[model samples]
Target: MARVTVEDCVLKVPNRFDLVLLAAQRAREISSGGALTVDRDNDKNPVVSLREIAEETVGVEILRESVVQSLQKHVEVDEPEEDDFDNLSLDVVGELSAMVVADTDEDLLTIQDEPDSGPIETEE
Candidate 1:
């Protein structure tokens, strides 16, 4: 896991064709890794090997299309809504971002408090 930093929250990604393809490949790698190593200070630097990435299950096209689709859908620039202000809180957005990329039900559940282990006992 990487330390959080302001630049991570705001950086312009190159949307050029070759760069987009490269990024999609990288995304696929991260998505399929046993775990990812991140270094925020190093430009949210990700250290993933192409060989390790190739071992991942995702087809390259699927990875590319998913990335392209998400970019196309949200290309418009807009003012942040009031609810967004709330939703964008460091805790909420950060947690939600984690949820978006979680690969396992167990990983997602780990973020939450344990639900009543088996309902609560009532006091008389």
Candidate 2:
């Protein structure tokens, strides 16, 4: 389980997967159905209210800490170079190669700029 500690709030998340799932779900719910209100006078911003969710869920705190620790561990390791892609799957390798070949600027015109394609624009 991971732990997220923010101020006096201590959340103990049961597992790594649950941490991401719960955070995402809570965030989505809050984003779609308005943010949760915390009755604390000290909390002013909407983001602060969101933090209350973590404070309420002890398990989530633990999971958050674990995620942070895992991220830190990865940060300490030296990143691999492009040459490390030798063993990658063919499909993934092909996709990676496509990044250099793809033309992202393909004729994507805005609606305002588009010629009146709906009906003829005759003189008034």
Candidate 3:
């Protein structure tokens, strides 16, 4: 079992900070049962990750992207998918936007006369 060090990885990843981040992220992936690019050589997860980075078996950019995705609080986009919106006709989109804009503070504050909920009151 050979030792893995930051110097070994620095050739592939120049920045010390970035190398640390990528190595740590890769270690987490390995611990989580992610596929390995190189032989483990009975090394620990962090060492195996460093070896992969040093040997260029695993791309640093991919590791960087993985780190970013793992750190994000919200993985999914809030906006609707483009394909769904594209399928709608222009007229339908216009009507939807119009409906969305039609709701005002006054409309939202007003209570409707429900059959059983309670007394309907108005601010006047």
Candidate 4:
């Protein structure tokens, strides 16, 4: 109990940085009313989290995943199924491919959004 918990935790979680993250995440969970796997022993939340990690009472992989989930700003959602894909194919092939009809009997008319103007000099 007197020994440094970080040293014991390093044996279970090799990376010191990841160990810190996992320990911090676990400590936050404890602060948020998560059940403790080990005795409080008058220790703080961080120390209790380290003790749990060192004793292998909590799964390190689960802690790692939870930390990742907590840090993610955007969670990916499952894509919709392909049930409506047939309708999309039909629309693209038939409806979308039709040409616009004009008042005159021209095959295709040029639709200009803006009038043509001479090039102007810039004050570079």
Candidate 5:
């Protein structure tokens, strides 16, 4: 089409703000060498984008997804696998438990000491 208007594009994209955002995003994509669904007609990228929207040549859902993706700074990542403590042998578990118990016992002994007891002075 020779002329593209908001009224024409609004039929395809109901929300004016969303229409603007999607059109701008599409324009950027066009400038970045994305294939145009409609003829360029020697017009600039922004005009071509509005024309595409007006013509319904490009899917609105696809344009919406592109806009959302372009605005995203962080992408979801899969959580790391849980540690396989179940694979540990009984002997290893027993040893680790014993070490933990011993450390706890040592901590208890230290804490039981009278708080008022002054630091022991010793000659070098």
Candidate 6:
């Protein structure tokens, strides 16, 4: 209780690297005004965090999630479902292509009748 050792905390967190990461994250939380799960006993943030881990006062899963969230720069979002607009656009393109084919026949006839004239310009 008076002194916190890595051996005590290792029982709760098996990996030394993971234990360091979680302890560091918890210490940061303490500095940022997060509530402590164990008695501080006038100890600093890191010591308090280690004590909490040793005593199993806080949930390891919750701490692990928090650490992962804090470290992540980008948050993934679910893509929107296919909508009516996509289908509508495809239908519009089909209609436009049909119209173009019909117009081409008339255009060929106009060009043959007026061979001397320049190309016909149609306004949309």
Every model's TM-score: 0.25, 0.28, 0.60, 0.63, 0.64, 0.65
- Model 2 is weakest, by summed lDDT over 10 consecutive residues, at 1-10
TM-score, candidate 4, is: 0.63
Compared with the true structure, model 3 gives a TM-score of 0.60
lDDT of 3 by residue, 11-107 (tens): 8889999998999999999999999999987888989989999989898888888889988997776877776768677769899878877775447
Give the local distance difference test score of model 3.
0.85
> Where is model 5 poorest over a 10-residue stretch in terms of lDDT?
79-88
Q: How do the residues 1-124 of candidate 5 rate in per-residue lDDT, one tens digit apiece?
A: 4588899999888899999999999999999999999888889999999998888888889988988898899999885445345455666889999999999999999899748577888999
Highest-scoring model, lDDT? 6
Where model 4 places Cα greater than 4 Å from the true spot, the runs are 1-3, 81-124
Ten residues in sequence with the least summed lDDT for candidate 3: 105-114
RMSD of 3: 13.0
Predict model 2's lDDT versus the native.
Answer: 0.50
Give per-residue lDDT, candidate 3, residue 97. Answer: 79
Q: How close is candidate 1 to the true structure, as a TM-score?
A: 0.25
* Per-residue C-alpha lDDT of model 6 across residues 1-124, encoded as one tens digit per residue: 4699999999899999999999999999999999988878899999999999999998889899999999999999776557667888999999999999999999999888875567788999
lDDT of 2 by residue, 14-108 (tens): 45455455555545545566446444455433334336555663245543664466457445557576545664666687897786455433334
Candidate 1 segments exceeding 4 Å error:
1-20, 23-25, 28-45, 74-124
Residue pairs in clash, model 6:
none
Which structure among the candidates has the greatest TM-score?
A: 6
> What is the Cα-based TM-score of model 2?
0.28
Regions of model 6 farther than 4 Å from truth: 83-124
Find the 10 residues in a row with the least total lDDT in model 6.
Answer: 77-86
RMSD of each: 26.8, 21.8, 13.0, 13.4, 9.5, 8.5
